[model samples]
Target: MSKIVVIDPGHGGKDPGACANGLKEKDIVLKISKYAKDYLEDGYEGVKVYLTRSTDVFLELSERAKFANNKKADLFVSNHINAGGGTGFESYVYTTINGGTTEKMRSAVHNEVMTVYKGFRDRGKKKANLAVVRETAMEAMLLEHLFIDTKKDADFLKLDDNLKAIAKAEANGIAKALGLKPKTVKKEAPKKEAPKKDIPKKDGKLSKVQVGAFADPKNAEKLAAELKKKGYKPFITKE
Candidate 1:
């Protein structure tokens, strides 16, 4: 068969990886993994994609790696968000057998993810005993793209457009590292449909929405408030 990719969105169900101001890392990553799969399928021909869990369910780290090894993946990219106060991004590969932290597979994945997300501070790649990286037989890397609990990283990640951009850039990075070229993402944002003449309004005020109706609404609203505090009027509506 052809070289395939196994994408794992770590954490799920009850194990909500990180929760900050209402955002859940597990759920967010799942969406990103799906976005990446769609991009690869439509843009990169013959590169099959497999996800460990498609729904909001949990998978043990061992099972996560087993999925990739069982599928004989050429690359495995596990998606995750950070917690606590860390800023910027980090990627991990298995600790090398020799003195060095990695071999070629580690270098390729680390270079790809970091190069694509050039704006974020380069935290540098390191050898980690992470389950997903070490256990997977295939070349593998795990990405912690921005912090969900930090004030700065969380703010940046709160926007749907920004999250999509990050995800797409990651897809591009993976493609580049793996020697595939991701097709040019469209430059234009799709025009929004005009609001219906008589759509019903809710709550006589804004009601808290259960996220996924849009991405990162809690953080998104916080950012909007910050923007307004700096003299910009921002609006919040479901997408």
Candidate 2:
């Protein structure tokens, strides 16, 4: 098995990323990264995984790449949700692999991730020297897996099963990139529906229900939890 992996969840804090139907790219990829890490670690032995940030904190793009470089990771997977009206998944590698055999790495990832979602557009191999891709030393792939602004994308991903499917596909993608035999995806315990945001009431009574446009669904859930603690019912709505 490939030795170490670094997963970077893009955008956090002030950088809310794309907004649509109350979902933010930061929160979406955070959920994916956590599950991907779990999917990989449980299914493979001697594989160490680390995330650049596990929460809604922000980091410069370059800093994220540096973390992976510092670790000398075998593979660096930068997770991001795409924007615009487009649908589908595309993987990016540096325009030049600095003479490294990284394009093959990118191809492996592209092939596996595109396997599950047939409707996804094949944005085939492209190049860019983004901070994460250029500065990283090891093989790396930045995934533009899905567009968060579109309902069709959200409808598919919001389902718990779809999220697990994505995680499995990503884990397999990395294994394939490193030219390792694919491993079985460890099954996830079924996840419940995402909790809703809360609303406050007047007249000295906390309302049993409230929902708001959160820009980020996870943020909405966090707000909901806080409201519930304050005796308000909360649910989240999209932009």
Candidate 3:
């Protein structure tokens, strides 16, 4: 069965979760979420990814969770950007869940993001009563990418490539956690051979031998005579 994954871009439209250094959490999370969805679908097989909101639109926390539940999602990943004075990456699961699939997924995702976003502070896997994570029916996790208010973190988040890296990391983590297989490309069919042209024939036989092309008729005749002596049926043709 195809595993269904719901990616929630934390804030949008009127609610820009956090804003700092001219960056809005709503926009950044949306980009990250879209990239993650693309990476997961393009790289893995038997997985269907859905986004709570694909555009800049507001969605209540309860609505996001309900959307995932409606889709019967196997995993719910809520993407967010931090704005606290501190800088780093962190992941959160529901405060009540422990030592289960949610925790395992949180570990996988956190480690993968930390691995890709190297040199950044590892804020560690944590638990929170965040609405999206807490309200979701399936295993859910919220990722705090980095502090938008922190100068260094915001600068890093400003890069499009960095966002893509983060998304790819999250996709990798999900694939690992779910044991999803990479997509296998089907081999192309062998091309058909071109039709063969009829070989030039002299009378009813194939013309296999070519005689000499000489500037002088005498020279051509001499070569043809030699070819005849050698048992080759040679005929001289003038250009």
Candidate 4:
């Protein structure tokens, strides 16, 4: 069975989760979430990814969780950006679930993100009563990508390549957690060149043909004898 994952980009439309360095959390998280969905679906087999909100539209915290439940998702991941004078990345799961599937998923995803977001501080795996994580039916986690208000972190997030790397990591983590296999790509066979046709000359003349060229006189004589047996007017000329 295919594993279903619902990715929520927190704070859209009227609610911009965080704002810093001339960037809005709503926009950034949406981009990262979309990239993550694309990477997961493209790179892995037996997985289905869906976004809570693909556009800059508003969705209540409860609505996000409900959406995941409606899709019967196996995992729910909410993407967010942090503010308030802090820098680095962190992941959160429901406070009550410990040492279960949720924690395992959280660890898998957290470690994957850390691998890509090198040089960024690791805020450690944590527990929270966040609405999305708490309300989701399946194993769920939330990710605080980086402190948008922090200058250093904000500069890094500004690069599209950096966002793509984060998305790739998230996809890889989910794949690992679900034991999803990589998609097999079929390779095309090489084409063969057509055989050359023997065309007559434009002047209606035939090209010269050499049937046999033997260095030894004995070999030449043997070829002539064989041709004569085949009713070919056999002749041997010495060059």
**CA lDDT of every candidate:** 0.75, 0.79, 0.90, 0.91
Q: Tell me the TM-score of each prediction against the true structure.
A: 0.69, 0.71, 0.77, 0.78
Model 2, range 21-111, lDDT digits (tens) per residue?
7788888888888888898777766678899999999999989988998988988989888888888888888877653568777777778
Q: lDDT winner between 2 and 3, please give it.
A: 3
In model 3, the runs with Cα more than 4 Å from the true position are 185-239
Shift of residue 10 alpha carbon in model 1, Å = 0.8
Q: Which ten residues in a row have the lowest lDDT in candidate 4?
A: 189-198
The local lDDT score (0 to 100) that residue 187 gets in candidate 3 is 86
- The parts of candidate 1 lying over 4 Å away from their true place are 97-112, 115-119, 181-239
lDDT of 1 by residue, 18-93 (tens): 9996789988899888888877777864578899999999789999998888899888889899887877788777
Candidate 1 TM-score versus the reference: 0.69
> Using alpha carbons, what is the TM-score of model 4?
0.78
Native-vs-model 1 lDDT?
Answer: 0.75
The numbered model that scores best in TM-score is: 4
Q: How do the candidates rank by TM-score, highest first?
A: 4, 3, 2, 1
**Pairs that clash in candidate 4:** none
Top candidate on lDDT is 4
